[model samples]
Target: MLTPESAAKFQEFTQAAMGRQTQVLINNSVVTEPWIRTPITANRIRNYCN
Candidate 1:
């Protein structure tokens, strides 16, 4: 069982997390370069096995 104080802190934490997610989605969005995301070739995977 949580004390009242602990429950209030938990609620505040969730609110802060939600605020950050909203900022990311609405403002400067995060993205990655498509060229850098190219699929790995078979040889590359083989090299890692060596």
Candidate 2:
């Protein structure tokens, strides 16, 4: 869960990264590079499994 401040910061980042390819990194390792289609401003993010 993101705190209110973190959520705002994430929103700002997404807006800045819009229309660009972004990399997800963990422990200095690249995870995935996804194109940013829209800005995400939600405070909570969820991953669903099938």
TM-score of each: 0.34, 0.77
**Worst 10 contiguous positions by lDDT, candidate 1:** 41-50
Candidate 2 per-residue C-alpha lDDT over 1-50 given as tens digits, one digit per residue, 9 for 90 to 100: 99999999988998999999887677988767777789988998553323
Q: What TM-score should be assigned to candidate 1?
A: 0.34
Best by lDDT: 2
lDDT of model 1, residue 49 = 18
**Considering only N, C-alpha and C atoms within 3 Å, which residue pairs clash in candidate 1?**
none
**C-alpha displacement of 50 in model 2, angstroms?**
11
